[model samples]
Target chain A: MPKTAFQRVFPYLLVLPTFVFVALFTLYPVTRTVTDSLYKPARRAADPSVFVFLENYADLFDSTHYLGARFVQILGNTFAFTLATVVFSVPLAFLFALLLNRQLRGTGFLRFAIFYPALLPLIGAASIWAFFYSDTIGLFNTILRGFGLTGVNWLGDPNVVLYAIVLLNIWKQSSYCMIFYLAGLQNIPRDIYEAAQLDGAGWFYQLRYMTVPLLRRTTLFVVLITVTYSFQTVEQLQVLNQGNPADRGNLLLYFIFQSIGERRNWGYVNAMTVVLVLLLLAFTLTNFLLFERRDDDKA
Target chain B: MLQRSLRMLCLLLVASLLAVTPFVQAQAQVVVDFYYPTAVDGPITQTIQEYATKFEAMHPNIKINPVYTGSYTQTRDTIRTELAAQDVIVDVAVMLATDLTSFVEEETIVPAQQFIDRMENGEAFVANFFEAFLANCRDEEGTIWSVPFQRSTPILYYNADLFRAEGVEVPRNVNELIEVAQKLHTPERAGLLMPVAGGFPIWLYQSFAAGFGQPLIEADPAKVYFNSDASLAAVEFLTKLGMPTSEGGFGVGPMGGSVWGDTPTAFTSGQAAMIYHTTGSLTNILRNATFEVGVAFLPSGLPNENGEGYAAPTGGGNLYIFAATEPEVQEAAWLWVEFLASDEVQSDWGARTGYVAATRGAWEIDPLKTLVEEKPQYLVARNQLAHAYKEFDSYRSIDVQLIINNALSSIISGNVPLSQAKATLDAAQAQIDSLLAEYR
Candidate 1:
């Protein structure tokens, strides 16, 4: 089969504008961020933009102050938060999807209930959760007090604020993940389940073997999306705790925000942005490698 | 069919071109968009818009748009980014005093005093402003980069009911304040309150430093004197008052409120026995409180000392004209600023919002004078202006405040010892010094 030159060029031409736009808006800024990471903080407003190669990176490793330690602490917080969110959210989403896939009454309404939180704007959900986390006047603490238990400062305590944020993140994002799982469940062959049932398999066995094996791709997709989304989850941190209670809940992105927005140290902020991009890239690569090995083993 | 399709395409192209043409055209009127941070409360945005409307009405030639940017720090960043991108120039901004130093250093704003001097109302304008107000508005080189708009200094706000209930005298000095706070503090009830959030703690600390006869920062403005003996003593004193019982100080607790909205509520609700806040909170108190409120000078450093009985830092908002604005737009802005400073407007603005007028003539107005006389707190703010000092001039003042506030919070929350807190503050100061040196 011979392809015409025009036919091959037509597709590339059609996508050329989009490619250019992405290059200008996304790739250029990212490259500039990486370049800026090599420079030191500009000494004076009048000083020429001199490149201080690797100085900013060196400062990140210095132990005189807690900047380096703080960076690691925030990174750990982000990883812990994201891991906990995925662990809770992925399983719950699968459960909801499985329940919704069943031939039951009000399944349509149940699907709607499962997907409702996905429709909420992130900051609006964060705001509502912030009110619930409020110490003096909050529903959660009030319930705790009613049970004759001492109220915990949900967002104020350094020990618990990360978990509180993770709780909020899971609450907002699980419904979204459930939608994907539900769609995946619908795509699975009904004949497989029916054959499993006829083979003396119960619902649990069917779900454990046939359904779970068939949903591996979907599960991989969900994990990748949720992990990336977690890295970029700035709104909840911004609106709820604002990385407060002594910056204990600060994520990498939130630290970047504080550096650029609050401190106006764009150079250092750009350096932090470079670090974040590398971190996310590493996570993505690890996910791909792990999933690819699993696929190979199954084959 | 081809002719009909061509006609349809022509019509679509014309519609699209019409939609794009206005964006290409240079607007007829000089539209000056001003981004202003709300200095006090929320509704003040409406008041600022009203002022913008009046300015627009007076000068139909120039359209003035006032955007309610968030906090002062937010406004600074927004303006800086806008300028860096060479986007729509923020023709004017209401910047904080602490922010003006950085903006001036960055060459983001024009010197308003020179611009004012170049204007027709130059001499009259220079004559009208208060000396202290004018001094605080100037840059390091004495160039006035902003005009004082809404100004305030910290004043003592006491609960009259609590004073009567505890049978304690009002504190006129720091020693007396400590004594009275000790006597008045009741656990699970009311105690003394100082806001350690945002810029409030810096104001309190700077005021205390000034009262202790200590310089806040060095003359170069690149160094901090925070770790000095007097400053450390002041921090120790403040930490002692705010520290919880577990930390070996009076167990006074932190109170929550928007600077303008919550302090009055805390006092009137009897959740706080005494509040150290700006007199700007006076209007909220007058409007909302049913409790009898007593106003007094901020407690002085020590008795029989050269330090004044009360010292206040210049706390206020300043209006800055952008360097990139057109001359005509600057003229329109000058006219509006002058109008705002006029006796009638200043008095009205003072009467409406609890801000003290930037000019002395605002106090001379009979109605404004009577209002101040009726509410002595307004008079206290006005009288405190003489003792008021400008906040520290440094690019890192806000960051320093955040560190100090967090350190103070740790002390107050019983998470850290006062000695450890002081050491942490000194380390924080050292970090700031390094930042200053790096920037320098």
Candidate 2:
């Protein structure tokens, strides 16, 4: 079939801007990071960078001193943080969505209240939380003392710091995921629930068999977004912990930040970035596969 | 046709005038980009801009572009990023004085000696600054690479009201500090707060090491005494302060460590009876505290053979001109540096911002002198300069600092057993040794 020349040219023009942007930002940086990971950066600008091949990667895992020993801990912290965020936030968000979906008194007010934490900037939220988490004069300790209970060192104790940060993340993130779940809830026709009610299905039974399955797509989407968001947690760490209290709260991203800012080891930092990128890619691929399998089952 | 051609000639003449004026202006103008960080509170950006405006007014041909970079750490990072990108946008900057070694190693900065030598009263100009403030500006060979600007040292800030009510004298030595702190300790208020928490405990910890008779870094940037006996005593003293009494500790402050930013607030609010904080916080503390505030030198636990028990590490920023700049631009930048470090400006800055003026001349000047007469807290930091040492700095400093800081935080937080504290330091020393292996 003969196509008009303008039609073909117009399509290329339409794609050009996006392609150029992706090439400049995403593709270029990723390629540069990969190349940088393979070489040892020069100590000084005048010195030439040495090609170290996979030595940077080996250094990351093999060397026990320096950042190597902490790498495992940081990797564990990253996974734990992401898992906890996803696990707690998804369920809490689902509960909020279900409650908000109900026709009840003060639903509008409740919706606003739940979403308030999400509205605050991460740094601002971290600052407020720092005040709340202060050991001597913080709001949390004061309240605990009022109840004749001993105060907890929320941000300072190595044991409790990660969970303290997790709580902040859950507080900020659950509401965000709830918005997605709310839209998902809206998309589900209410008549199906009514039909289930007519069949004498208990609330729990319907929730398990009906509401849960219906929201699978939304849950998967929310989980994917939340997981990626969890992996990129740096600002809160910067403001609240700075990978401190014995690096208990140090996550992968903050570790990368320290590597660059403190050590100026671009090669090591790039290697860390490469590992992080691979981790995210694997998670995304797994999610995609899950989604594809579900579609196949339906087909 | 003749009239049209005449009009065109006039237009061409006007266009040429407009084009040539900027070129002439460019020929006469040398623009210097001055980057500074505001580590303390108040209208710092405005104050810096005001100084730049005053300087520009005096030298109309040289334009001063004053950029308020976020914090000292941020300013260093920004400069490093620019250097790595080969942009070198900053002509002169107020970077951490401890960054001198790093800058020298990278060959990114021109030594201030070159410019000072060119000055008529260069020797006196260098001598005008307090010796402690100049400690961080020189390398092993004693080449001056920076000019001291916003210099400070840690001092003990105590609640005078609490000390008076308790009927106790101010602690002058480490042993007395422990005794006084323990006596003032209560369930509600901590006796002492040392703001040596998180990633950078080495600054305040240096005072402890120096008091114990072993400084962390000397002029030799290749070496540090992280595992020295004096270093061990310093850490032990610091650890005992925060440890519970049952655990063979002084049980004074929080178990891990008090935060840097919260230290002044704690003292001012009476949550802490005493705190080790930067002299930069003096004005802020005086402004906020309802009770009388007393400033004293940091008491090193043991007295030196000279019978001096006080020790502190000097900190804060120094003005550095980068090497990448044009010679004329570097000269212009040096002029801006001198203008900022001038006695008049230094005195005004010290009085306004609570930073101890780098030069003794600034101390003898009007505003600072009068402020000292009225409050007298400002003089304590300057008086303590006699006991101050160079801050911990070396080749690969940030990396070495991280190792030491992590170890100290772990030890202080009780993650490392007191029995194993020495072992932890040894491991840190090993890491630092490897890090500085290239230099050696």
Candidate 3:
């Protein structure tokens, strides 16, 4: 009844490759970045590298300094961008999913049309949008001027720039979220809707009662994906904003990218990264608690 | 059967080893990996490849690999990453001339002077480049760090059709600029477009500083004068471009400022009567415009003692050799650099790409001469070189650039009141001083 050597070692061998890769790529970099966050690079050839533990973090939030002002503004911009994108895109995606879920003529073509924006590279989409948003001689401006109205600066006004970018993000991302919602929709038993209809439930009632409750887990999953995506996108910002109009569009990831790419301020950026990771971790923990409690209640 | 299979495997392995021997022998030919950046609109990568092919045909023992890294900043980032990881992918690269300080600080580059010293006509080679173009290629102690290649200056591109219709003469100085712009201003068309709204405004802003008789930096990399009297005058003039005359402003461009990529398009379409853009964009704008385009020096804020009022900041990339590569590879890379900066190649590159040819000799050559004769606007940028100063560069240049950019943006974009302009600049100067304090 004793196990053979091959049998005993088979499971460990199976997990080893993945473990090795994770350790090398993910664990190693995370450790290195955390360590790097604590140390300032030597600014001069004669100077030694100095460890200033939490000072890097403090420098980011000290309002008397320029970095502090930038950090606060960028952090606010990132959060607002994330909140706006999620709030708008999720409902729009759900609507699209609901529409596409119904059996209709030309639904396949319509679905593809709706999903086409998601297929274009974000950078390409941002470039195309840049032409549309140009303050002078743009599509919107030309149309506005044709009607004898003043054309608004979509990308130039700090008040309107974030919303302009958010609109693009929604246009690009809603269809991607729609794909998930469509898949989630397909899994729901059709008979539930049919039964609700038999009980004289209206379309709104059916969606609110049967569909919404059934898709809680899917909605949760979609929210998590969208939130992560909102935090990570730097392409649109790079192409469309470049922190222009007085750096109003500067966001967390773009700030970090500028820090690393332009300034080579590794220590400061790493501290920023640590703060970002902590924020994301908080969100994930909240989601876990909610989902875990829901599952326990179901059981 | 097992014995027969084992013998077959051994035979295959030996055959593979024999196959690899010739591949290893191909290493006798030095392969130089050249990475260059394209900041302008054109088929730059294709042209570089064509040059590489020609270079290789001439020297069969050497191979050239031309890589098109994105922007100057992106190219620097890529190279920095390679150096940090000790991967050493690039043998030679085209980076911003202003990047000399940072690269030298990193000690990742071999000074171009060393290579020139070994050449037969080293002094003649150094003398070939315009003094203005060479400004960014030297350090505080005057060691040449890079060879100027795709060099440029910010010049004024005006809609000549609009100027003629409005009875506006070409602006020579600040007063003329204001007069011409105010006359040309209309509800439908902006009078001026200063493309100083984006991530790196310091390049264009430096032109303003120069016009006001205060170049941002000179021989000293540790020192910068962001809040000097001349710099303050420059900021005041810039801020006024977005304000109304009733408010003691020029009433020209938008208060929020204009985008870099959008400026050329706007000027061509007649949305703006004039624009300040890089000479690198000359070809694209000239080709696209339906109306006659007038190229002029950036209007001066104040004339110097010599009565030379015009001022611009020289820009664009320089070719540098990496120190990490093998000696033979470095030698090959130097040969490739020499070929690229040669008069014939410089002429072709400038004529095709609209860059001001780096060497004076290139300007006197065939295609460049032919192009200048056909479109005299091509000569305005080169003429402006007399008044051009070094682009803003200092220790920790990237950070310094961003600080100056933000400070300028805050002032010019009206985020901060004009009254606070000095304070903003002072703060930025203080920040840069602390950042560069160690170097001093």
Candidate 4:
């Protein structure tokens, strides 16, 4: 059957504006990033433009630098940080959410206390943590000194700085991630827990067996989100560490920020950004597929 | 009846005149969309807005609309993005003096001298800033692209009471700094503190390098001496200060971890006997310090073999007038710049805000002189002006600084061998060279 003119134009009309918007906002930048990464910018205003493909990438992979202080080391630290935050924060969030779900005195106030860090801006939170980490007047060190012990330089020490940030992030992220878990826990029928209890299952047993399996969907969501954010988090580093002393907290995002934003090395930052997006995409896809398959098997 | 009609006609004429007057007045007013960004302090914006209001009242024909962009970098990005959109988003802006090269590249801002050349007292106004500050605003061709607004230099702030208690004088050179720091070091107190986080190590080290009679940037903008013997010696001096207690680095204290404002916090808490920071921090330090705060010149640089001491590096931002073809808007921007640069405004700003008034005339003003008289601490930064050099600013300013800063951090923290510091600096020089070569 021959289609009318209206039919022929209908699909294109429907798709074109959305495509244009996406292209303007997203695809255009993505393409520009890819192309821009091929050329080095003229450093001096008077210099003519020149293309230097793959040179920026080569700089990243420079092998002459120390293993502990190289670009690869920064990437490794980013991954280690992301994984550590997820592993530690997600379960803690779940546990808190479960406990808060019970009708208990002070639970209302308790939820606010847990969730307040999420309310503060990330940099503000970092600053607060910096106060606690201060050697002279900081609570952590002051308390230690009162006991006749030497104070620790939490953010100053290379070995302890990353963990100190991680601890602050956990304190912050668990509060935020708890909200999602609370909503997820609400969806779980109370009957399952009551039925398990009737069968004389302990609270720990119920939490381990039923709660864990039931919260799988929530756990996947929490993991996906927390993982994505942990890799990109730069505020704490910018505020406290700035990925100092061997790029301890220099995530891919910060590397991009310092390289491109501060230095005008857009080509190198674009190259790094491309790699970062690909890694994140891979991570998201793996999580999505693994979870979706698990659900399919159960069904 | 004829007289009554004449009176009605007169009233109608008056009403019509009033109706037309507003439209004419609106057309007469030139609106200057100004972008002013303060990265360090938030309150400075309120002060700027008040100044804008005052300017508006004085120049009824000119209206100043001030937009407070978030940070220095954010302001640059926003202006760049705005200009890229083919929009004149701002007619005048306060941006980092070091950003002159980039603005010139984009043609987003015009040379202040271009506009200043026509105004009364223009030449003197252009030259009013401290010599060290004016250098940052000049291009290689000697065009003055911006006029100084907020300017500062590093100064030494120590606990006067602590020094007295310790029975020691303030450190004047590397030897004294180390010796005094060792004497002052305790489990509870680090003798000295200077921030090393992010790009600060380079910022503060410029003072040391200058005092050693080594300039970081050559006369040629394209060439820099980051890995030079002098800079290495400066870095080594810096590393020694932050060395472990066993290694005699008591001077660095817990400064490796503290960045920016925290250095002041460390000092005010009595954990640090002396600190190296900007004079901009003086007011905040004074307000918080429980003990007597002493302001002094930065430890005289590691004296050269000839016993010459180089000056401290001047740092801060300037006001750049955005390029506009419209004569009225361009003229209005100059008015705003000149007003902001006036001794009255500069003095008021200097007194209220901690930033040093950039204009030499501002220092001569009676109120400002009285301020210097009342708190001699305010004079330390100004006194260092004679010894001050232009800050190490180039086209890719942050990039170069970060490279050097990271190297210092590695030397101090990685406990890397001295040879490795050279390697790190060589890598920086290579990167900086690559960045500048195409333009050169």
Candidate 5:
């Protein structure tokens, strides 16, 4: 049962380049971002890189920028955006995958149409939606005018804009999730469904039990990716609203971006980045370790 | 058949693009990565490539690789990211004039003054630039960090045909503007459209501030005078224009929906009679507008006791040379900047691109003069230059801008009270003061 030393070393050597690549890009950035939060520019330090820990984090939390309106609102917005997107996109994608899984005429064409939004550059898609939301000459307004109703400012009004982007984020991500679900559906053997039918289980019951449990792994993967995508919601926010109506659409990553690009507060930005990374890591781990493991424990 | 042809064409296009670059970059000793933004809406990237080609022919020793970065904001981010990642990259970049302070703080760009000093007629070359255009490009120490390249100003573009039909003259002041708007407003058409979007709200707001004879930011970039009596009157007056007639104000309504880009379309499509936008959009307006477009200075606030026109803000990008190991590279960047600024080049560039020439002398040049005759709108923008001052910029410029932008967005939405607007300014001033505290 003794393994040759070369066999063990060979596996490590084969994976060495990939490990280095991941470490350099992924692990290194995470560590650097964490360390960078500890540094602040000091007048006495000629280099402008002094290690003043936690100052950046403190400055960000205290209502610094928007008079008395702190980042508490922004974090709330990010959470709302993430939860709304994951909730709508995962179920909707599953619905789409179920619909398309049928051997029906025009299924191929329907799939293409459903997935079209995902193919366009997200910023460009945001622009198209902005035009639709535009008051004077937008499609929605034009339709509203035809209906004798006043037009809604979808991207400008604070109350409506968040939902506007939520609607858009769902549109953008549903198709992306659908592909994974479609693959998962395909992987589920047809005989399993046939056996369910033979057992007198209805389609609804089959879907709730056989199909849902079978696709747990796919749903987990989709949720993980979608949650990550939701946090990094910059492109559409910039295009449609630029995080406007008093930062109503301002998500966490967008705030981090503005901190770096707008404020040049490197230490503060890194602190926010570190916070976001930790939150995301915790989210990912909880999904996989807790909810994701429940099925295995049951098995 | 169509799909097959499209695929073939795509393959050929890709092949040709791959084939051409190696041949061009091969013979040059030094290749400059020149990144620029498409500030003006046009075939600007193609124009840049043509200019680069000419520069390459003139300087056989140097090859220029022009990268068309998307927008001014994107270009700034691209340079910042590239510099942060690569340390020393992008030999030269065209960035927002207001970005000089941040770029200097980041150490991504060197004082272009050094590059100017090493050139032939370098001193004269630096002096030839208009000082107003240089306002945002210099630090507090008066160090010139960038060369004015593509510059523009905010102005009022009116629907001349609509004005003629309504028998309305171009409004000279805020009171008169509302009077004219009263005559022009229809159930179907808005009397005016101006941008209050998060993108360039501050630029257009400057035109209003100047009307009240106050600059938003004092010459000292650190000091902001936003809550002054004049500023309150100016913004409240603007708010009144968009306030519904039912609200004891003009019926234009908050127009919170009309973004800067949408403003131009509103005027062009004849949905709105007047619009406030950048002169950078003049050519695009002219090309697309069906009606005869009239160009005029933004409506001034109550003229000062001396009766001066409302001040406009100079806006656009300037070229900055980042420090690199090779002196030759910096030298090449200097030459390129000079070429871009030269009267012969800028005069034609201004005319073709609708950007104002950076140098006063360029206005006298034949290319610009001839274009002025062809399109009098060019002269109107140039004439406004005298009233135009530098854009309000300061250290931590982006942070200050975002604070102001959010405030403007809030005010224009009509939900926030004017007092909230004042409070927003107060908070922004505090934040900006704190941002500069580090430098101290």
Candidate 6:
């Protein structure tokens, strides 16, 4: 029995290296960030050793400075961006995966076409989109001008910049989500669909009752990953808009980066980072509570 | 069979380790990494690589690693974080003109005066550099913490073809320039292009403010002077051009429609009539432009009634040696700096690239002078240098610049009234004052 126990524990022991790597690389920095957030350190050259406690966090709420307002706005923008991405991308991915599964001619080519955007580096993709968003000499503006329509500032207009970025995100991420959805589709038992057909169930009925329920885990996984990535989206904002047109497109991650990277307000950036970690924790815990029960019920 | 496999694996491992061992030993070859930000396109990366290869060949004992670390701001952040980790990985860096003060405060850079004093080969290295370049390199104590590498000032680049077509005379002063711009502007074409983007607009406004005898920051360099009447007038003038018609705006400012995409494309493409851009853009313009380009001084906001012009700000990059590197490496780095700053090298670099040479002797070099005679744009930059003011480089200056830029953007977009804009700037000045107190 003890031998069996040791054998059972051996696999975990073998995986111990990965655990140590994660702790050192990920947990260490995160813990450091949390600690640093509480203390303000002088970041400039002349006076390098001054430390003030909790003042950095207090600066976050100093309304006159606009940092606090900017933070709240960025959070709202991040949530909106993530929610829109999930709403548009998840359904379209599922639909595309369904169509791809249909043994249609040139389906492989179609899949390749769909997957192309994901292959591009973020900056490269953003650059291409920035060209398209250019007020003059852009493909969109050219077409609009040809049609005698006024060219809108796609990036410069704060009202539309967020949506424009969302469009870019959808283009890049939907294909990625489709790959996952297609895998889930392929794993659904052929016999179950056959049984459904024998019972004279319609295609819609089978898809509604049989396909979606089986893909619940996949759907949950995609939503979680997509939301996490949305919070971390910096490249598009950094390259294309750079929080332009009155700082409208600024997201939380980019805001934190601007604080530390551009401004060198390390203490303020750390405090914001701690807040972001708390947000991520809250999101993960809520997701677990809501979905883990459903997963158990389904099983 | 297992013994044979083990013998083969051992042989493979030994071979691989032998192959890697030389590379590991090569790392011990006085390795010095250089971090530079390319102001131009990716082709500059090749130029940097060539410089590195030459340096390595000259000093066979040292291995030079050249890294392109993105924009100026990105390079600053990367170097800071690396230094904070106590990693003296970057032995040399190309820093923005304004970044010297912050770097010195962090003790991330060594004073260059000692290196200037130590050069071999009977070279009068420090004396050869342009006088205007010293304003940025010198610390508060008048110590040379950095050496000017690439120097540039804003100049007016107009499409001569467009001016001829429109029968508009080149403007010598701001008022005439605005009148010409109004006449030259077509809805289908841009009259001028001012970057409403961060920093560029502020720089343009500061140029005008400087011409009007207004300082961007106080003499102490501890507080912003952007809330002053002169600055307010400059902002008002800029905002009139940038605001939309619905907001009672004029249109895009000077470089607007005419400025090209990345290169001098807009002017070359006949999209705009005139452009105000850095002298560094001269080479790109000359190389790409098929049209006759007219080079002139930047429009003077406070031109004498007789149309005499005052100088604007000179903006560009400088090279700083880090204090943490070994003495030998510092010597090698200084060798590179001195070589680049030599009249022959500077002239060649200036002729090849659009950037003006940091050394004054570059103008006396026959080839560079010939290039300038052929291309009047080069001469325009040289003439402007006489009137150029160095941007403030105190630790709080960048933050102050950022604030001014943000406020200027608001003003230009017509989101804030003139009084409100002034009030906003006053608040920013207060913030700058606090930063100055804390840092300076």
Query: What ranking of all candidate models by DockQ puts the best one first?
Result: 2, 3, 4, 5, 6, 1
Instruction: For residues A1-299, write the lDDT of model 2, one tens digit per residue.
Output: 88899977998999999999999999999999999999886888678789999988888886455878678888999999999999999999999999999999999999999988888899999999989988878899999989988778787778888999999999999989999999988998989889989999999999899889888989999999999999999989888878887788799988998878653588889999999999999999999997968789989
**Candidate 5 at B417: error in angstroms?**
2.6
Q: Stretches of candidate 4 above 4 Å error?
A: A1-24, A42-59, A63-70, A103-105, A193-205, A262-264, B1-27, B39-42, B105-107, B119-122, B165-167, B248-252, B255-257, B303-307, B324-327, B415-419
Q: Which is better, 2 or 5, measured by TM-score?
A: 2
Instruction: For each candidate in the order shown, give its overall lDDT on alpha carbons.
Output: 0.72, 0.88, 0.86, 0.77, 0.79, 0.74
Local accuracy of candidate 6 as per-residue lDDT tens digits, B222-275: 556777887777777776664555666666442121112432566667666777
Q: Write the per-residue lDDT of candidate 1 for residues A190-216, one digit (tens) a residue.
A: 887788778899977887888888889
Give lDDT: candidate 3, residue A284. Answer: 86
Supply the global lDDT for candidate 1: 0.72
Residue B46 miss distance in model 3 (angstroms): 2.5
* Model 4 per-residue lDDT tens digits across residues B139-236: 88888888888878888888999889768886666677777877888777777777765446777877777676678885566777887887887887
**Model 4 residue A5 lDDT score:** 100
Q: Which digits, one per residue and each the tens of the lDDT, describe model 2 over residues B1-440?
A: 99999999999999999999998977698999988898888998889889988999998889999888898778888998898888989999999999989889889999999999999999999999999989999999899999999988889999898899889998888878888999999888899998766568888888888788888887789998999998988888888888889989999998887877777888888899999998888888999999999988787557433546567899999999999999999989999999999999999999999888999899888899899999988898999899889888899888888888888888877777789999999988988898888998
- TM-scores for every candidate against the unseen true structure: 0.85, 0.96, 0.94, 0.89, 0.89, 0.88
Q: How far is candidate 4 from the true structure (C-alpha RMSD, Å)?
A: 4.4
Q: DockQ of every model listed? A: 0.19, 0.60, 0.40, 0.38, 0.33, 0.21
lDDT of 3 by residue, A7-98 (tens): 99999999999999999999999998899889887754335558999999999998655567588988998899899989999999999999
Cα deviation of A226, candidate 4, in Å: 1.1
Recovery fraction of native interface contacts for candidate 2: 0.51
What lDDT tens digits, residue by residue, belong to model 4 across residues A123-143? Answer: 998888878876567889989
Instruction: Please report, as a value between 0 and 1, the fraction of native contacts recovered by candidate 4.
Output: 0.38
lDDT of 5 at A285: 89
Best by TM-score: 2
Task: Order the numbered candidates by TM-score, best leading.
Answer: 2, 3, 5, 4, 6, 1
**Model 6, A1-299: lDDT tens per residue?**
35788899999999999999999999999988877776655565435544677777787777555466356667788889989998999898899899899898999999888888888898999989978877656678778988988776676555677899999998888888898999999999899999989999999999999999999889988888888888888998877766654556668888777666443567778889888878888998899999998768978
For model 3, the superposed segments whose C-alpha errors exceed 4 Å read A44-48, A262-264, B1-27, B303-306
